[model samples]
Target: MSDENKSKTFLGFDFSTQRLKAVVIDENYEVCHEADVEFDVDLPEFRTSGGVVRGEKGEVTAPTLLWVKALDMVMDRLIVAGVDFSTIEALSGAAQQHGSVWWAKGSKERLKNLSSEDFLHTQLASTFMADSPVWMDSSTSADCRAIEEAVGGPEELAKVTGSRAYERFTGAQIRKMHRTRPRSYSATERISLVSSFACSLFLGEYAPIDLADGSGMNLLDIHSMQWCEEALKACGDEKLSKKLGVPVPSATVVGNISSYFVKRYGFKPDCKVVAFTGDNCSALAGLRLRSGWVGLSLGTSDTLLLGLQEARAPPAGHILVGPTSEAPYMALLCFANGSLTRQSHRDRLVGASWEAFNELLQATVRGNMGYMGIYYDTAEIVPRAVSGRWLYDASGRALDKCAPQFEARALLEGQAIARRVHAEDMGFKLDSSSRVIATGGASVNKELLQIFADVFHTPVYVQDKHANAALLGAAIRAAEVWSVHTNTKLTGSEPSISPVATPYPDSEAIYTPMLERYRQYVDTIPKLQ
Candidate 1:
């Protein structure tokens, strides 16, 4: 709480609705304490004409209550760790991007009651328990299509917001919320991005939305770095303040930790609350991927991001927007496709134990481009509006037909081609001449890494996913705030391993014809409209 203790330590939350990762790092940036709090994301389903759905189909949404539980668990873990709640300097967070949480008009005052035993018992508990639509669930594609028609299409949307109206984007979700839940939308005080909501609540102020999360919103004007007045007015809200709107630097000192949080954490009264950011941007920071360093994330989804010195609107279908951090900008191309696709096919054939699949995969010699004949879809269902059309074989079987292993190889080949196309479309080349670093779960897989290296014809550096980089990035933001506010010589989160890489010992074959076909397929898909 005093000037002497300001440099002690810091804390952060990687706030996901499903699971919360709490991290404690001292002034040296080493992990002193950390815990992952898991909770159910009980999003009730809405009835659809076909089935229960998420956005338009009577699909259910994640409630704000789950978020509250995640918070409670995170807080409880931090407390149990015997962390000097006061020495925690300040906190910020990384959360699911574009998900919205509503609050009553004056909920700002309500957050200061951190010590109240009635915390979960309040109405706030119930709200978070339901309807927190994550940044997936493409049930709202219809809504996106409608909006695209009204707003002149995806290119128009991109020109203004640096993104298209994808079903998973926050903009489509917002429009869906307004039409289906007018009362809730009207009663909503500030439609908080999950990142902003957490930072605002803990800091005891109306926290500003940082560039990363704000960039996910189709409503935010990427060129100007503010909410688009025309879009907001057209969306039927003239008063912009009610919605979380503002683009602050990633490390901006939004405010100090509220007395309630300080007392609860036992942090000094002067602990500063840093600006919050999104998981994607936080991951970039955690990776320590600076300029000229391209980051490839192969998690449940795949994200290829390049940090830049200034903001640039994504050309046509490319995604160019604010870095999830305080950097000037970052260009990202994310595909909903990833290991999930591989798992689905494996689930069907290999059953619950993936060890068998791994063994089979390991024993299977890499034939000269075993997947060269297959054509996988990028993002699976975008452009063509199709899903799971496995159309390929490995052992020189059928012409237009398929084999069992077809799906598995297709998923990989498709995503590889998708990555290659995305690079070229975004004005970046995928040749061996360019620099690239791969992160995420898939990066650890030797085969996947080799495939990517051969496809891009570039060496792929594997990053250590040891600690959740996003959580560490959140700590970086928190540490920065603590330093500037209290003159604390706090440490920032950084990667332990260097990103330099070496090639696999296997033959790095190139399938020129397959690469050509994949590029053609991606180019033929209709633009968003």
Candidate 2:
């Protein structure tokens, strides 16, 4: 692309659990340059194992300064890659869903005056709650139950908020903080989800949480797209609504790039900043999924996402507001054990080598000779939520032993089966014409994807650069929002979505019994209250 075309460039950012990635694309949606800053590797001073600080009580958090530091580092790296920031016409971002960032009183003033001479973290180190609670935190079970009971029951809460009170959602987290740290809760002037916090950094002001991301908070009424009074009261703060500003549409332009970026990185002073949304919503946009297509994301938490024309809140899973500013919704099923559980198996049985793990997995037959198991590093979120490793026989009876090969195959098959069962429960049907698109870190594993195909009994599709879909999705959102800003039609044709994994002809014949066994035997598995 030439300098003239550079004026049409759009930049997108993804503040994921393990990394902060940036993707720059031209109006044609062709990649111009990309860069990333890994938390563990690049910001080692924070001492986070998985980009979060974990506690014995199921607490999980990250230093807010670490995220700020990553932004500075990533932008520097992008500049080094020859990205001309001034030419970037618009910017948007995606963040790990459900994480909350607490901004200290007067932080907006601090942000507005950021010095061009210093890095972002150095200036804004004390402007936020020292630690930001993340989606991995499960310490708020008590609060979850309280909120559910307060709203009559779990079913009622689901009807109102599109999901039952989940431990990972922001409402429970806020309630816990309100009870334990009253001073901090009172001192907090504004609370931003991870998405809006990143947006605020660029906008130099507090950004309203986008509706799509806010739906995950358990406070928004899905039907009205506003905070539910009962839900807010249950969170222990009658005034919390003011702190969590009104949500804007995902495509709304929040503001221009902050003057700090204009001076430090050469961004155009008038460059637009679109509302940032949850990473999952961004993934839906990146995939450009059509009706009859479902997406299985293999990230920190494995998610099965299906687009719906009308909203319906199911007892299990979630119905999130769509990425678009219109009526469509996205049905989502999230599993706590995704790449981490798979990595644990790989380390124990295959010396942490994907190649060796793939070899062992392929060596095993369909049912693993009657050995089946549920492998969870932590509690899961499908069917009935539970934790721990469970082994069973072909008749669905408990077993004391299983071969490592069986365990390996069971891990892959178990996840596939869980997603399939939950998707069906949410009214997703897999037929002859249905297609599955796989993304995230594990999508590159053809061996694992074959399991997905066989279990879902459908062909799995992938884009050319599927792994970075979240970042790419953010970029696309930025471009789309910019088009709305300028009232101009976007220039590029949509990218081709193609199949990368297909099931064998006998897939259903082989896995039909296994699926039935899973449905019958899962009831026998232990669960956490």
Candidate 3:
């Protein structure tokens, strides 16, 4: 290989819930190297578990500077791992959705002049409001209600913004901050979603929020792909639109890597920076999901995503502007208690071993004698179900509890059913060729994969890398945007990694009857007040 050809690489970052991770990929889309900085374990001074501070009334936050510190630590770790920064031709990233970062006045000036000698957090202390409400936060019910009413209720709001008012969304979070902390709101110079915030760190200026992630904010008019004036007014920010800056396409080349990176890490002076996007949208780009396939992510929160040729405002779930420019769209449904809920059941009933949990799940018969369950250790995003686990008999009668064997099967079945039903509501169709491509920490479990296959009556597939797809997608996007920026040969648009999953013959027969019962079960559960 020629030196010039081999010298080029791309960098992708996923500023996920608990960690900030960097992945370096070669021209061929192979993951060449990876490194991560864990928030709680590595930066204990922030005192966060899973990268969030929990408090009364369902308040959830993370120190804004903690993210900055993670960026520094992750980069230093990458340099220590012997990554050649000079080879990185371009970079992009993904962030956990809906978390907002408030920049103090003159923070951009501070960013533009970062010195190699000083740490990022050291120079940028007090640059943010510090609370930065995240996706797990549910303290914005009042804001949500007000926004819904302002926009003519939930359905109308959904039609306008692609979602009803969501507590974790940026619109509600911004309204809460604006109302409760007028001083901070007034002092804030600009607002960036976590994705744009990370991008700004690299651009040395505030990056505009990408449409893919901005759609989650409940502030964008999904149809027009512009910020909604009424939605801004509804959020109590008449001047908020200016604070938000203009939205940009997800794959747009934002700018060159900031001089800070060049001076600090010996990066190319002209290394390009692509716009960052929300994690889910990045995963969609990473998976290269076309029609007839749906991606199921089983992480801290379970999310089901499908690519859409056209946009629709479902009363439930979300429709993000697709990662690509043009007319593509994405449909998403999120469940708050994903792996954690399953892990809790595993710990309580199966000794906290995934193998043991699978054993019990395998031992139990299909449908667990007609028992169905909804497990929400915390509040759920879809259906907005009440907190606590709800179990039901075959006939849809509520039960106080079920046996351990039943519990294991029920949890898996309930989650799978929810994904299937919700995806259908969003206009996803299943066929002989349709596949459920599973990814996340839990996707590796054979037993769980089998349940996904059986419940959806579709084959379930997992990637060989088993790495974070969102991060990988960022790397892919960086490559795409780099070609445009450099005016070089364009890379292929499809995802390099393909998933492989098998289907059992009896899956359809096993799950078909249970599907009907699930509909009844959901209706019977009382809504949390």
Candidate 4:
């Protein structure tokens, strides 16, 4: 570390569903400060539950100005915590993937001409034409179906845009807006993903979507790293292309800090702003994953991220462009029913105790004595299954119920196996050198992690600061971009990680046959429905 660089710091912000978090790291890439603003708690005026408003017909959205206000509040909180904003050389951020923000006609001028005398949210209160449909929204199923059909079919759409048309994707959401809210859609001048919208706040101009995050929307052609015209027509019209602008590489330096931030918050005028990306892509950067390594985030939903040398248009899951050059393509598999499903079963069958749940899991033998089950408390994304629970005996005959220990083990094993299956289908190769970097709320559960290790036939590792991966990733990206633009070197440090679980010797032998049986059971799901 150079003495000249010792005083420099970088900032990373995360605009998540429930809260907005900020992480500051010095030139050494070590965290020095942190702050956050919870939407439901800090911004009560929005009347949001879990940071969003749920309407009829499975619609979920968040007030666009709510995020504007959060940025205002989070910066103030950072200042209150004694962070020296002037010493911050660069900043970047990550946001929940797939949420689209509509900038009303003439809003670009409003963003660029902001004054330091007033708060950002107050000035931009009417900038958006409508609330932003978030990732949790399922109201776009019909739109998704129409898009897939227009583009030939599910497989062809996947080949073009990296995944089959999904309800939460921004393209479908945009299509819904154009159909149901034509006035708002016509009044809109520019459309930004949550990631780019946050970046635009810093740039004081409309920011182009980064390749990594742009891939999440069904509008981008991952193969060409450009917008797909056919896909765009499927969503709306040719004019939609201009509203999206051109996409940029994730690490591109978008611009300098806005004058509003410079005068109001004491930020350096020359501080750079890197293009922001999806939270999952930022987490991938934060973990510093390498070849043969996969990242598992076990939270409200479970997502598996695999870095790919080349893109694969899997029938299930999603493929995104990597944030950094080391990995050019990435595969993502999301399971909608994660911790909540486990908690439900635990509450109903094990006295609502995780310790008891663990005890039950430990008491049961491998493969749950050939008793397998699939549980979805809500609609599942991977297999597209509806809410239901199906259990089977060794011979694959359906059963109404099973032993509590067996039930507990079944849920854990089922989730692990499903992750492995979908990941492999997306071209994830497991071998002796392969390892899983686990993070998120449920990653702390050693018993659950063990099941993942056994099912994937690989060891599992966790970092000391796993929960803040998205925030850290944004900071890392900021530092990387700043270092390149300034021709300065960074004092890099390895993350503090340790292996939490290793596969048993007979793990592969035990779970190999279960994979086929699990698939067979999954095939019978729609029939049973």
Candidate 5:
């Protein structure tokens, strides 16, 4: 690569639940600069707890202008960090999936005529119709049921929209808005997912939702990669389709940076804005996962991601169009009880020391000597269960308690097994050739990763930089879109990954029966309920 090519940087932004993060990468994918703005800390006037406001009955939201302020703050921080915005050739971003932003009437005109003299929040203070109902919100059960009823049932809804009517999904959220807040719905001019809303801020107009992110809404037809007419009517009226602009391919260059950004932030007038996508899809691109490979992100909430040659709308989990045009489809399975559950158990049973926790885990034998457990510090998504812990002895008799070491091992093994079972149920196959790429906070725990390897009967690998996968993915998308648009070939080695753990020789034999037993427990729980 020439010096000029090396100097050209691509920027990726992540509008996550808690913060707005940005990463800049050179042509070779080396991270050059990074910055973030935490909504609660940096913009405390909004009085958000964990970046959202909670209300009665599982209502969670963030003020729409909070994000606008975050954008301004993050941009200023990037400049203060000595980042040259003009050198950035292109940019792309990802946001928390399923959060919807309603643009009030005439907001597009407001976006187009933004003044460089003022901060974005001040200029667009009244642009939004209401606080955004985020992915964490669970106040839409009635809306979900209505939507499911409108389109047959849950199975048929999944067949058409790549997901059942999830309460947090955009379709259900939109229905809630239309039915409960009819005036806001009537005054709404456009509906943008968190991803496209971020893109619109850059493009100076409403940006189309990308196919990959659009799939999360329970509104897009996964097979055709377009909005489903039936699903649209289920969400709102005839104008609902227009509120959501045409969905575009994830890598499509939506437009150039808005003049406000060009003037205020020194961004080049020609800097391309690639279509933004959901954070999960961005991580898939960032990890460079191939077919048959699974990406496990072990953060506050664990997520399992894999690529699919053909789309399958499973009875659970979700299916999204792949971030890049080359890949066909992708699956995302979220487990709500992840690191927090692990931390709680470790604190209670092992004195809050990870080293002690690891020692206990390593000392205990696999399958906990026929003991099995399922722990849910909070509600679980994969199984859709309530909070509690269930433990059983080898003979399938309920156990009131067990040894601390057995408890630790059971916790790790159970989480791993649950991931594999749910993933396979989604049609993800496993074999000698299959690989599991682990990322996020827990991936650093070699002992935990070994449990993952052993339970899945596959090798587990970790990248040099796993924490920034989503931000890196956005940067990668920017570079890819730029390469195609300018007809330039990128010359660089792919990001490197190193194997962390390989399956034990007897892993399949040990876990196969355990998997069946685990399924039996899961199947019995609903009956007990």
Candidate 6:
């Protein structure tokens, strides 16, 4: 590893809610290039009428052509940004989880439309049925419950998937189609996450779902790395389950550089297209966490991530399914409301940027909110649901009725409490022997960092450099390939360390006693209820 020997580059993109972000990095994780794409509703939007019908507030797909256009517009932005697009060797992606992009097999040339809008109109959507049920659409709980009941309830499913079934999961979405939109389910030929869809587009063939993204679906057998027959039978139409594309190892190589590439970015026809993974796994890879290290993803949803030496089943409402372990083994604790609650609600009241939102949180005095004995469990997606329980005696009761800010603080602390409880449930012992890296929207907040420090009681480090570290991590893998494909023999691998993170001592001051009360509430509130 000579300072003179600069490594080659790989490109990484995280296809997140309505956006695709691409980052290019050399072997040492240095940024060489970057770009992005955003999505508008290409599907016929549906609104929920209080669960009256199967309409269930889920928007069907937009014409495939429209999405392809959106993708190209994004690609154009990159070319303008000065990306070499050609010298890049491989294309790997991290996409939003639980999306289903349907493609029918074509002749030797496989004729299809880009999910772009230019080619298809709304009328065409009805014919091709191209929209994917994204993770944000939480309209399938009834279907989730049914699957749970058929499979023997939440605990049983958790034993296999490391997660409790959720409506946005592939299992529920597929089940919904089977029961209500039977025709569509029957007509469906293949389904893959948006990440794999990205890979498939470049492969000039069907792309397999990576283990990291597959576990989100409740259909993948977390342990065996195969689809569970019994789980499929429970959902409906076991035959349709077979159509659920092959389960590929997260690191496996898919065919490289398809016509889509030659047509879109003009990268080399011989470039490799490796397996694409989910955003969470890519984020973990971005940070380059180690065996005992933990990475917290504070996105629309919050996921507590830790790498595993091998795969393990989640006890309940928890999941361990990804190529990050044993080729892609990583466990996750996904809370429905993470930074999203703030993204949705922060504007109306605070009128602050998310960064500024943390600024205000930083201003609050710890334990000084004077609100005692009250924990507002506003969105209790994980841990125990407290329903905004009140805790305290006479003096503390005053602290119970928090202003909007207090409620805001509660949202932050409540999630931390959930993380603590989940970690305990995960059953690992952490000391100085462990390393914790905090990355994501929420982690950037100094106030939240202080609160986290108080809660975790250890120094919290922030990856303050890039907005796309996860994408850069994928690019790092590409650098690995370049080293293998062109340069020398395998060599010593070293750890990737972010700058010694600015300490969250200010957050430490804010969380002091408020954290204690929050913990007390966690223990007594559930029992009291």
TM-score of each: 0.84, 0.97, 0.95, 0.92, 0.92, 0.81
Across 77-190, the per-residue lDDT of candidate 3 in tens digits comes to 898888999998999999999999999888878888888788888988878865789999988999998998998999998988899998999999999999999999999999
Model 2 misplaced stretches (Cα beyond 4 Å) = 1-7, 325-327
Q: Evaluate model 3: give its TM-score.
A: 0.95
lDDT of 5 by residue, 1-529 (tens): 5536547889999998778999988878888888999888888899997678988876788898999999998998898889988889999998988899999999999999999999999899989999999877777888888888888999999988888888789999998998889999999999999999999999999999999999999899989888888888887677798999899999899899999989988888999999999988998888888767899988767889987777878899988899976578888998877886899899999787999999998788887899899998755667877668999889999888899999899888999999999988977898778899988768899999999999999999988754667778899899988998999787644689999999899999999999999999987664111
Please write out the lDDT profile of model 4 over residues 246-362, one tens digit for every residue. Answer: 999998999999999999988989999999999889888888888889999786678898777788788889999999888898888888788768888999997778998899988
Residue 180 lDDT in candidate 6 = 78
In candidate 5, residue 501 scores what lDDT? Answer: 99
RMSD of each: 4.4, 1.6, 2.0, 2.7, 2.8, 5.5
Candidate 1 overall Cα lDDT vs. reference?
0.63
* Count of clashes, each model: 26, 0, 0, 0, 0, 30
Model 2: per-residue Cα lDDT over 6-78, one tens digit each: 5578999999999999999988898889999999999999999878999878788988889999999999999
* C-alpha positional error of residue 72 in candidate 3 after TM-score superposition, expressed in Å: 1.6
Model 1 poorest ten-residue lDDT run: 43-52
Compare candidates 1 and 4 on lDDT and give the better one.
Answer: 4
Of the two candidates 1 and 6, the one with more favorable TM-score, higher being better, is 1
| Clashing residue pairs in candidate 5 (N, C-alpha, C atoms within 3 angstroms) | none
The best-first sequence of candidates by TM-score reads 2, 3, 4, 5, 1, 6
- Give Cα distance to truth, residue 77, candidate 1, Å: 2.4
- For candidate 2, the C-alpha RMSD (Å) to the true structure equals 1.6
* lDDT (10s digit) by residue, model 6, range 212-320: 7787888877788788776788778868656676787766667667655665566777777778878777777776777666777766577777777665565634465
Per-residue lDDT value at 529 in model 4: 16
User: Which 10 successive residues of model 5 have the least lDDT summed?
Assistant: 520-529
TM-score of 4: 0.92
Tens-digit lDDT string for candidate 1 (167-251)? 6666677777677778877777777778887787677666888866787877777777777765565455567545765677676
Each model's lDDT comes to 0.63, 0.87, 0.86, 0.89, 0.87, 0.61
